[model samples]
Target: MKTVLITGATGFVGSHVLEAFMAQADPMLRVIAACRDRRKLLPGFAGEVREGDLRDADYRKIMVEGVDVLCNAVAWSSLWGHVADSRHLFLEPNLALIDAARAAGVRRFVNTSTTSAAAPEHSSDPQSEGIPRPLWPHLCNVVKIEAALRTAASADFQVINLRLGIFAGRRYALGVLPILVPRLKTHLVPWVAGGRTSLPIIDGRDIGAAFVCAVAAQGLADYEGFNIVGPEVPRVRDVITYLHDDYGLPKPHFSVPFAVAYPFAWLMEKLDPIVPWEPLVTRSIVHLMEEVGVDNAKAERLLGYRPAYAWRAAIHAQMQEMAVRQTRAMSMAMPIV
Candidate 1:
């Protein structure tokens, strides 16, 4: 049996990966978790939990020992703000984790990443060099993480980076949908570029399945990357229209080109100190509106990844969860910093 250690087991990506690993019910696989709080793990999860913070050197060192594969689903996200904190809280720690995994004899490392990491013009290139955005520091750090993995990969230590599209589904609160849907309710959100760009949203279940494929797939290179998106990439207009018609959410009342939207967003960010709440819009959100012409062809050929859920179903699942939870609007930064 090949031992797989899943970091961030209590998180959205990590939880789904754990579920996929367990649902397989294969005698050839042995799964465990590394999370700070074992109590937060999914119900019916009877696997071993190596509980501790990744920032701790000892914990990072101990977690990957004797593991055949390390699925590093742990992620720190912020759509805008918190530039300085990212290096210490996210980038440095993830880099340390990668170092630990390599030193502990782990043969394979699977990393979590996003599609927007690349420049909008070069997004179609699955493994293109990531272009940094000053408006979104955490996103810029994601690019740095990818570069680190590429440098870390070797003949023995194989690294697989999953460049996932926008996240949707249950057990998560911070994403485009949770932020956008609430903003739409205010009836102030406008269509950037007339809502014509593609939104490559993917279901949490599909995200899990892709990881399963990467973990088991053979004949992969030492450093591998794939763009894993939904089966169908929906237009922004179609998604907002569906919400307006079915869920009673409001659609964008007007349209603005990218040139106008970026400046407006910058002004909102400038008003941060005086405003009682977070900015209604920001440049990072506008960045998400850019056309990311990504597809699933590469993932299908290499990892045997096939996304099963549609955009509507994924949105519906998140909307339902937000109703029960999400007491307040999720900010672009975690811990409000």
Candidate 2:
């Protein structure tokens, strides 16, 4: 039987990945989930669960032992924490995990990366091609991680990096949407460049399926990269408008050009520490707005990844889930007779 171990199995993306593996009816596949907290493991999960920080050498040894494949989904995510924190909290741990996986004789290692790594200059075509420029600090760190993985991969071990697009759907805790939602409630978000920039988005479920494909794929190079995105690319204006309309909230009326908005976002990021809450805007968010489009064709051709949801359908599903949760919350809050 082939054994697959997933790190960050309790996190937003990781949880979905875990579910995908669990749903697999393959009796020959043994799935294990690793996270810091066992209590967070999915309800009714029957597989082996290992709880501990991957940074600990002993814990990593236990997690990788006899594992045929390793799916790394953990990240110390903070839109405000720029390069320094990213390197310290995210880059270091993940790179170390890669080395450990390689040494442990893991046949394949799958990593979760972001499409923003192809920033400063993006392509409109359906190909995974771009130059890495230091436009966004978070993506810069991802680029560094990708380079490290490439260097570490060998003929005996394979590394596959899936550069995922902006994520949405239930359990999505990071990305611009979570930050933008609250501001949108108060109509505080501005229409940067009339919000016409193409926002490449994918459902969390699709992302999980992509990971599953990576694990099962064959004849792949020792080191390879693929762009993972939704079937349809929606403009920012459409997404924002859909959110407002779905929730009966006011839409943003104000607008700003990229040149003007970028500086303002930089200033907001500078003042984030004292603000106590997340900044209404950040330089990283601004850089994301400049992305034209993402190509998922590479993933389709290479991994046979076929996304089931488009941006519109994904957003609608998320809003419906949110409404159900709100109704349940209100029911719980009502005073009993």
Candidate 3:
């Protein structure tokens, strides 16, 4: 029986990955859920659940015992506020996890990374491979985690840093999609500019499947940085249009040049460095207006990673799910006639 240890087992992606592994793997596989709070974990986790902070040496030592694989999904997923903890919020805990995993004799390690680290081709920065600065602290953790994994003393543990594109599905962060959906339905969220930026979206559930595949793979010498993107790319404009069509709302009014959006992004970034707890729009989102499509051929060939949902279908599915939720809410709110 394989023993798999998962960090961030309570988070959006982490929760799904835990479930996915349970479904695909043998019932005998020993799964350990290592998280900051075990009570926050999803209902009916079929394996051992351990409470531990990723940053603590003792926590690592306790959780990694007899664990053959480690999956890192822990992160600061806030949108704004808490600029002071940027370093600790991302780098410290992530670095600690990588170091501890190597020392613990874990055979395989899979780390979650977001696509925000990739620079657009038009970016003026000279260092293409080098991680760009001024990144959202959560996303920056991916880069730092990857670098740390590379430098870890050549141990038997093989690391796979899964660089994920925008992911949506059950329990996802109410990112651009959720925010835009309600606004577009009410005609509040505008397209702003042309909404020309192409978005590479991957289903949150499919991301779960990807992690399962990573765990199932026999060896990991060739498995490294792979961009997990949707099977097809969808422009932001089309996404908004689909929302308008789905909800039968008036087409969103457009204004505010793309250039103007940058300053709002700048202010949002300045106000919220680690996670934008409160902001009209944050830097990570501002960059959303910019193109972020990625090639997933490597992931396809390596991990047999294929998105289970299409971009448009996935977008509509999200809106549909939200609609069902709203309907339930409305039904519950009615005067019990």
Candidate 4:
């Protein structure tokens, strides 16, 4: 049987991926869950649970042992500052895992990434290197991780990078809805570029399916990158309008171009140190709002991916979760230790 290890199998992305893999019920495959806290994992998750920290070199090595495929969904994300943490906490361990997995003779390595990692000039291509913004250091590290993995791909070792879209759905943690919705209630957020830019929101369930397809895909080369998105891409206006009409969340009172928005976001980041609370907005958030011309054509053709979830349905699902769990505005950073 082919052993497959899923790191952070309890997280937003990891949970969905884990669920999809179990749904397949392939007799030839053995699913192994690798996480720091197995207790947080979803109920009815009947898999070989390997509990340990990804940071531990010993644990990383042990997890990949005898594993033919390793899907790395672990992430330490921060919307705003914390450059040092972004590297040490998030980037470094992921790099170490790639090396460890490759050394352990893992046949396939799947990674979680965002479409924003692609350069604006080459927005359509998920494999393209993105422009690194100085304000958002985490994004720079994301690009670096991609480069490192791409370099590791050889005839013997395969790497699949799934450039996922804005996340929304079950186990929804920090994301567009969780972050932006509360701020919208403050009546502070404005429609950047008249809310025209496409919000490439993809549900967590579809994200899981994408990873499953990537794992099972055939005729794939040593290194493959695909833009994984929802069934349809919606505009910022369309999403916000629905939130206002359906969910009764306040909409942006005014509009600003990307020019004004970027600087405003920068100023907010600069003020974060003096302010007792998190910044109302950040450059990274603004960066995400910018046009990313991502589509599922490449993924569909290559991975046989067909996204079924729509944007509105995903947003509603997220709002429902946020209503119960989010008692306060979400912090800028996600630190898992």
Q: Tell me the tens digit of each residue's lDDT in model 2 across 127-240.
A: 344445554565666777788887887788888988888888886555666566666776777899999888888898898999999999988888888878898888888888
Can you list the residue pairs that collide in candidate 4? none
Model 3 steric clash pairs: 79-275, 79-276, 80-275, 80-276, 80-277, 81-277
Q: What lDDT, from 0 to 1, does candidate 3 have?
A: 0.67
Better of 1 and 3 by lDDT: 1
lDDT of 4 by residue, 132-226 (tens): 76778999999889899899999889989999999998788778888898899999999999999999999999999998898888899889889
- Give lDDT for model 4: 0.89
What TM-score do all the candidates reach, one by one? 0.97, 0.88, 0.82, 0.98
lDDT (tens digit, per residue) of candidate 3 on 64-105: 888888888875653443444645656687787776777778
Backbone-clash count (model 1): 0
- Which scores greater on TM-score, model 2 or model 4? 4
Clashes of 3: 6
Task: In model 4, state the lDDT of residue 309.
Answer: 94
Q: In model 1, what lDDT does residue 248 have?
A: 97
Please give, for residues 1-337, the per-residue lDDT of candidate 1 as tens digits.
8999998887888998998888987788889998888998888888788998888899988889899999988877788788777777789999999899988999999999988988597787777767888788888899999999999899899999998888999887478998898899898999999999999999998999999999999999999888989999999998999899989998899999999999999999999999899999999999998998999998899899999999899999988998889877887865511
What are the runs in model 2 whose C-alpha is more than 4 Å off? 82-85, 120-136, 273-277, 320-337
Question: What does candidate 3 score on TM?
Answer: 0.82
